[model samples]
Structures are given as structure tokens and as C-alpha cells.
Target: MLSGRFRLLRREEPERANAAIGLDIEVFDAWTGQARAAGTLSGGEGFCAALALALGLSETVQAHAGARRIDTLLIDEGFGSLDEEALEMAMEVLAGLEAGNRLVGVISHVAELKARIPARLEVTPGLRGSTARFVIA
Candidate 1:
């Protein structure tokens, strides 16, 4: 879903990347279509690429390994970095993964994201402490 440019390559040399932080990957600009280092991506773009990778790997596991079923995916805090279009795409991907009794949980402080989510647990921070509430919309 990432403009068809999401690629996870297994390169062992540090010369290929700045840091071998694990999960070697590269992505192309959505508009420019030019290949670029995944590390060089803007915060939002990097988040998108990482999410796509996670989902892709999950699908691979589900496909090749019949003994396991990935039924839960939880994402925390990257929503605010995404632009409207990217956010929409990310949300759509997350929603699609919810098929087959899977539970997708997103934890974000973005108001736009909160508004779009129907069923959510709202956590409020007050002077004294914090309070949490759940909505089953």
C-alpha cells in the first residue's frame, strides 16, 4: 500500500547503511518515485514504511507458517506525524488487518485520529492523576 516502493533488503554491510539498527529497508518517494534510504525519510514517511514492513512480515508469517496466526497489532504514537493522505492510508491498512477476528489497537494523541476511531478507550490526565474511560461505539 506504500506506493509499491516498500522494500526490505537483507544487507549485512554497514557500508550500505548508516547503522545496522536491524530490519534493513529502503523506500521510494511517493511523489518523486526516487529511491532513498529509509533512514532519510521524514518522520511521517519513516513511520509509514515501518508500519508497512510490520504488516508485511505478519502476513508472511501467517502465510508460510500454518502453526501461527497473528491476531493482534498495536501501534503507539506515530499518527501525528502523518499528513492527511498518509494518515488515511495508514488507517485503511490498519482497518483491513482487523479482518479474521484480529484486534488492532492504536494509541495516539492526535485529535483527528481519535475522532475517526469509533471504539476507543479515552485516558484523561488531570491535576491529581489520570482517569480512563472506554467507549464501545
Candidate 2:
């Protein structure tokens, strides 16, 4: 499940980690094919792995007997470190979820990500504290 989901979310990553052991996942370099602890992953890599795990878990829950189907998911932060290609991959996965009638809300401050997202709720620090603005398209 983890391997398939990771590939769906990160096609560029060719080699997907085996995450059956919870937080003790082992990641392999796509080119080198060398495996290492998940902790060795860079910020962007970690974020992608975490997102894949969340998505896989969501699917598992929805598929479980007598479990209610989940319709919404909210991810806060973690986009800033991802390079353009990786971010695009993540966005593609989220778009798939949206297409399936699921609501995927991403809370991020990265300008690039913000520009790509069609609708967003932005929060900015202000003199009083913070202010939020909702944007559509």
C-alpha cells in the first residue's frame, strides 16, 4: 500500500519506501537503490513521505469494515521545502482526491504553492496579531 501510494504521489521518486513499520520506514535512493532510515530524508523528502502515509492511512480507514468514509483532509505547512517538481507531484495527488469528491485543504505560506492553488485562505501577521484573507481563483 505504501509503495503504491508513494508512487502515486511521487512518481519522480522511482524508489518508494516500505512503511509497514509505522514511523520506522526505510527509504531507498531511486538512482543508487541504497536504502536508509527515513530519518535521513531531507525536509522535502520527509514531507512527501508523510503526505503519502497520510493518504494511505485515509484510504485504509475508508476501506475498513463499518468505517465511515472520510470526505475532508487538511494539511498545514510543509510545502516551503519542496522543489517545484516535487510540489507539482504532491498537488497532482491532492487534485486526484478532490476529483473523487474529497475536500483537500492545504495551509501553506509558500508563494509558489499559493499561486498554484485555485482557492486559499491566507493568514498574515499584522500589528494586532494576524489577519486572514480568503482568495478564490
Candidate 3:
């Protein structure tokens, strides 16, 4: 699953090296096809990779938890840097989680995300104080 997701984000398979000391990951650029250290990935690319890994871990946990699969996932501001196409891809992946009866909560200020999400909890701050309202579309 991680491999497939890496391909989705990078258009190529991710290469990993297991040194005696630790693990090293190389993520290739989608356009240039040049590999770089995972730590060197841009914010969006790193988010994609981290999201893939997290989703995989969630799946594993659910599978092993028997009758107690995780029911909720909260993503906060992880969509800040994704472009349109990457946003669409990420949304598709997140939608799958909801389809499986999990509650996916995304906390983002991105306008495009607000349009796409069916439900939201909006927070507002004024000189007086702060307020929050939940809306479902």
C-alpha cells in the first residue's frame, strides 16, 4: 500500500536502504526522477508520504484489533500544501476511510477543502472572544 501510494505521489517506486545503523529512504521527484533523502521532500510531498504511512498503520491496527477497529481519524492542517491534483488524490484516499464507516475529521482552513467537505466545524475569533459552529451540508 505504501509502495502504491509512493507511486501515486512521486510517479515512481520509493527506494529504501537498510544500513546496519538504521533505515534510509529515498523519494524520487515526479518530474525530474531524481531521488533525494526523504527528509529533503517538500512539505506537500512529505505530507503525502506521511499520510500514506499513517493510513497503512491505521489499517494494520484495525485488522489486528479484532472487533475494535478504530472509528475516527483526525487530520489537522495536513492539506495546506497540496495542489489541486494532489488534493483530489488525498481526498479520494480520505473518502475511502469514511466509506468503511470510519469518521474522518479534517481541520483545514483551505477554501477548496471547505467546498468539498460535507460537514464542518467552523471556528471564528473576534476581539471579544472565539466561537465555534458545526455545520453539515
Candidate 4:
């Protein structure tokens, strides 16, 4: 769930903001004005942007429906594409959204991200099939 309006404005181009839906998000190439090739975002930029858009849409929906509040967001396994700086920025954005009962869960295998977000629920193979356990730092 999201609170208020989530707007993603390019630092330079404020007029070209695009709307995004829950897991369905769009990634635009500012230079070519076209969508990137499918599964071609090498540097986490696509994932980060898509996440931002989803957040925006969720917020919009909540406000339009007059919901009082909502909490939690889940992101799974995509941090490998980002560089250190971009990763840091993404982490900051997620961390900064602590207000309004927002809880962001990033599911990632990257060691850096695992170390950064110390609390997590890990799932692993067990005697039968798999087991899940929460790890908190």
C-alpha cells in the first residue's frame, strides 16, 4: 500500500512523467524516447525506475479511493543490475519511505543488499522441499 501521490520526475524533464501500475511498469530511454529492449536493463536503472512508478500508482489509487492508510511493499530479486551508486540511491529511497506505516521488503540475493538490509525472511531447501525463516539484525 502507498500513501499520497507518487510522482517520478526526471531531474531534467519534468514534463514527460509516465504513469505505472503495480508490477507492470514502463522504462523509457530519455535519449531515444523509446522503450528499452526486453530484459536488457543491465544497470538496475530499469528496475529502480519501475519500482518508483509502481509506488506512484499505488499512492494514486489509495488517494482516489479515499483509503485511510496502507502498508508494505514487496520487491523481489533484481538488484544485481545496479551499480554501487545507483544501488545506494535505491536503498535510500526505500529506507526514506518509513513514514505512513510504509514497510518495504526487498528480496535479493546480492550480498551487498543482504548486508545493507539486515532484516529479512530467508527461504531455503529443507528435508522435504523448503523452509522459511526470518532473519533480523
Question: For all the candidates, what are their Cα RMSDs to the real structure?
Answer: 2.8, 6.8, 5.2, 7.6
- Best candidate (score: lDDT): 1
Scored by Cα lDDT, where does model 1 land? 0.79
Please tell me which model should have the higher lDDT, number 2 or number 4: 2
Q: Write the per-residue lDDT of candidate 4 for residues 62-93, one digit (tens) a residue.
A: 89887845588888877888777778777877
Clashes of each: 0, 0, 0, 1
lDDT of 2 by residue, 17-112 (tens): 643343445666665556666777788888988888798888898789478898999999898888877888888889999999999998877888
Give the C-alpha miss distance for residue 56 in model 3, angstroms.
Answer: 0.4
> How much lDDT does each candidate structure score?
0.79, 0.76, 0.75, 0.66
Runs of candidate 2 with Cα error greater than 4 angstroms are: 1-22
The lDDT ranking, best first, is: 1, 2, 3, 4
Kindly list the per-residue Cα lDDT of model 3 for residues 77-113, writing each as its tens digit: 8788887677888999899889998999898888888
Error of 4 at 129 (Å): 1.9
For model 4, what is the alpha-carbon lDDT of residue 19? 48
For each candidate in turn, the TM-score is 0.82, 0.77, 0.75, 0.66
Q: Check candidate 1 and list the clashing pairs.
A: none
lDDT head-to-head 1 vs 2, winner: 1
Candidate 4 residues lying further than 4 Å off, grouped into runs, are 1-43
* Candidate 2: residue 7 lDDT (0-100): 33
What does candidate 1 score in Cα RMSD to the true structure?
2.8
